[model samples]
Target chain A: MQYERPKSLMDAASLLAGAKGSAYALAGGTDLLVIMKNDDFDAELVVDIKSIEGLDEIRETSEAYTVGAAVSCAALGESTMLKEAWPGVVEAANLIGSTQIQGRCTVAGNLCNASPAADSVPALVAAGAKAIIVGPNGNRTIPVEEIPVAPGKTSLEKGEIVEAIQLDKRAPQSGDAYLRFIPRTEMDIAVVGVAVSLSLDDKGLVTSARVALGAVAPTVLLVEPAAEAIIGTKLDDAALERLADVCSAACQPIDDKRGTIEFRKKVSGVLARRAARIAFDRAGGK
Target chain B: MSAIAVSTTINGDEVEFLCQAEETLLDVLRERLGLTGAKEGCGTGDCGACSVMVDGRLVCACLVLGAEAEGRSIETIEGMANGDELHPLQTKFLEHAALQCGVCTPGFLVAAKALLDANPDPTEEEIRFWLAGNLCRCTGYDKIVRAVQDAAQELRGS
Candidate 1:
């Protein structure tokens, strides 16, 4: 095995594109290292990109907050600007692992690892976050929800890397929240995760809303119908019920030991309702 | 197999070592540097038995490659002592009877130290959340929690 820490993005891409055999980019290594340690595992090149300049920064501008792809989950959660701007997004990122693991886990790595139960993906999607993809094709922005097409897979082509994730600035009276259902209280994968971001008008009606679901499908699902159900309402119980119905209807889950298909479907709606309520309260609802 | 030469600060001492590409920092600390305080309960990150302070952040040393430790500062359980004296956290753990099997002690102590360093007066909820990564099969964590709270109070007092 060859481990090389490339100082530049171009050099990292070149090393990955030119490697003789399988190559894995090291972004925190909370997951990749475990995969490497598995029996019969052998990767010819391991490119450490955290050493690259500017890959560990969290910069907040007037327009948006740019989180470097290699930024640790703990650091991202502790970022004051990000926490204030996108509290739900930051909290979800922090939920990926425990304190020890969060210290070494990255949001980009979590997305690229492509776990259907990725806690951060649903929140990022609800926040309309964009990933800055760079490669031989140059830089392009892709929605966080569109990155994952299947479990353990991503839509990113070979030699491509996500340099950063961008969450746009919110208008006044906006709030977002993410909730996940796990059998255990902490340190467990989400059986069902829901993230809701909404902006309330002066009259306390939802002007805009986005609802994203996780672990009930091949990838995190942005339920537009669910969002539509709440967008024009005061987020009353009636609208919340309608939102839950659509959110549950959007599931495409499989049976597993952690949770059955029916259980996940039920929890999906329950989580959506609760998250939306929290988000509404945070948006200054009476 | 080629060895990677790395220079790092371990416990405030400048140290140099040659390690394999795949060698985890846990392995280097335990074998190469003879700092065997960090245990390997689970090679995977599931267990925080190998927890250490890397650049002032708590992480599972097993998840980090030794090559990645180049030019970084590392703190293990061995670093919890000041020469022949014990750090307050270490003393409180003993005073509170926080250990039974003693395998996960080092990890708990290290993780608790990290929490106190960041937030001197953390609530019970904060303490539980911070040490969730460090799993203990024995003691049920009650004594451990008391130890951390007592240690925090002692630090705040002095």
Candidate 2:
């Protein structure tokens, strides 16, 4: 195996495009290195993208925030501006692993790894995040939900790298929150995860909202019906109940050791209701 | 095997070594440079036994490639103490009898130091949460937590 730290996106793309065998783009290496160390792992090249200038930065602008692919979760937590703006995204990223893992893990990697239970994806999806992709062909931007096609696969083509994740500047009275259920308090994968992002009008009616569920399907799900249940309403008990029912109905979960199918379906509703309440409160709802 | 030459700073000393692309920093530290203070409890990042600080961020050495350490600074368990004198955390650990088997001591100490460096006054909940990644199989965590608390107080000089 060979390693190359390319300082340019084009160079990284070309390196991956030209590789004769399996090639991987290394962001944090928290997930990559684990698989690389496996006895049966076979990889011919690793292109480390950390050397690229500004790839580790969180660039904030008037319209949105551009989080570089190499930005660590720890760095995300440290960014007070990001935390204040998108607390759900920041908290979800911080909850990926322990402090040690957070120091090295990247949200871009989490998205690329395509784990249905990835703690950050549901929040990012609910926040309507976009992924900036750089490839040998050209650069393109796509919705975060479109990147993951299956349990362990991504929609990225050969030689394509996710350069950064872009989150839009939220409007006034906007808030988002992410919640996951695990048997343990920390350091365990989510049994069921839910994220809710909403914006309320002066009358406390939800102007816009998004609800995303993780660990209940092959990929993280954005339930429009669930979002619709709360839109134009003040998220009263009836509206929240409708939102929960929509979330529960949308789940296509499997029975695993972490949770039974019934349990996941039921808890998905519970968590969606709870997360929506938190997001509503954060948005200054009554 | 083709080996990559890397120049890095470890424990305030300039060091250079040859390592493969896939060799982890923990492997390079323990096998090449003879810095075995960072043990490999689990080659995966779950076990914090290989915890170390790279460029001031605490991470598992087992998850970082040695070739990626070029021009980076690392702090390991070997650097926790200054010369013959033990650090406050170390002294407190000894005073609190924080070890039954010594394998996890280095990791716990390194992780604790990182916590103290970031937050001088950590609550018990914070301490427990911070040290959750570093598992002590001997179940000596209560003493370890006490040692860290004592060390924090002593370091603060209150």
Candidate 3:
């Protein structure tokens, strides 16, 4: 294997594009290293993006925040500003692995790995985050949900790189929360994950909302009906019931040893309701 | 394949080594530097048996590339002791019987040191959550938690 730590994004892209065999970008390398150790990876060229300028930075403004692809999950958890702005996203990303993994795992790597049960993808999607994808040609912005097209595949073209993930300026009277049901308290993959982001008007009426689910489909699902269910209401029992039902109705899960189809469906609804309730309370319900 | 030359600071000492492209930090520490304290219970990040601190951040050495350790400050279990005196966490772990086979002890000590360095007084929940990556297969976590709590108290001079 050839490991090339390019000092610039342009150089990195060219190196990746010009590889003769399997080329991979090394971020935090939590997942990539594991796969490589198991002999499942055949990489001839690897571009270490951490050497690139600003690729490991977290840029924050009042309007939005952009986390560089190589930024570790530990950095995300430590940032009071980032956590204050997007608690759900930070918590979700922090919950990916153990404390040690957080020190090395990148949120970008998590998205690129494209696991169906990714802890951070749902929260990123629910927050309307966009991934800034750069490639040999140039750069383009794509929604977080669109990046993961399948369970283990991404929509990124050859030589394309995720520069940073940007969360748009959040509106006031809004809060987001993420919850995943695993068999253990930690260090376990999500059997079912849900993220709910909602905003309330002056009267505490739900105005804008987004609900996303993970591990229930090929990719994380941004359930429109689930979002639609809670909008234009105060998230009362009826609205929340509809929200749960719609969220559950959108699942396309497969029966696996970890969870049956029926169990996942039920948990999706239950988790959706619980997550929405938390979001509602966090938004300072009147 | 040409070996990668890496310059790293471990335990306050500047160290240099050459490692292969596929070599992990844990491999170099154990094989080259003879820092055998950081065990390799599971090469994957799932087990924290190879946990270390890179630039003050707690990380599993197995997940870090050996070449990537260049110009980084690393702290392994070898740095956890002070001459003849064990660190408070180590002292408490021995007292609390936090180990069975002793394979996971070094990793736990390193991880706990990182935690206490950041937050001297962590809650029980915080300690459990922070150490969730370190697994003790032969023993349950009750003693480990108590050891950490007692160590924190000891370090606090309480």
Tell me, by DockQ, which candidate is best.
3
Q: How do the candidates rank by DockQ, highest first?
A: 3, 2, 1
Query: For candidate 2, lDDT tens digit of each residue in A1-286?
Result: 9999999999999999999899999999889998987899999999999999899999999999999999999999999999989999999999998899999999999999999999999999999999999999999999999999999899999999999999999999999999999998888899999999999999999999999999999999999999999999999999999999999999999999899999999999999999999999999999
Instruction: Sort the predicted structures by lDDT, highest score first.
Output: 2, 1, 3
**TM-score of the first chain in candidate 3 relative to the native first chain:** 0.98
Estimate the TM-score for candidate 1.
0.98
**DockQ for every prediction shown:** 0.81, 0.82, 0.89
lDDT of each: 0.91, 0.95, 0.91
Q: Place model 3 in a CAPRI quality band.
A: high
In angstroms, the error of model 2 at A276 is: 0.8
Interface RMSD of the predictions, in order shown?
0.9, 1.0, 0.6
Residue A35, candidate 3: C-alpha displacement in angstroms: 0.3
Q: What TM-score does each of the candidates earn?
A: 0.98, 0.99, 0.98
Model 1 lDDT tens row, A40-138: 898999999999999999987879989997899999978988888788999999998789999989989898989899999999999999999887667
The residue-by-residue lDDT of candidate 3 on A152-270, one tens digit each, is: 89999889999999998677788999999999999999999999999999999989899999999989999998999999988899998998889888999999977989989999999
State the lDDT at A134 in candidate 3: 90
TM-score of chain B of 3: 0.97
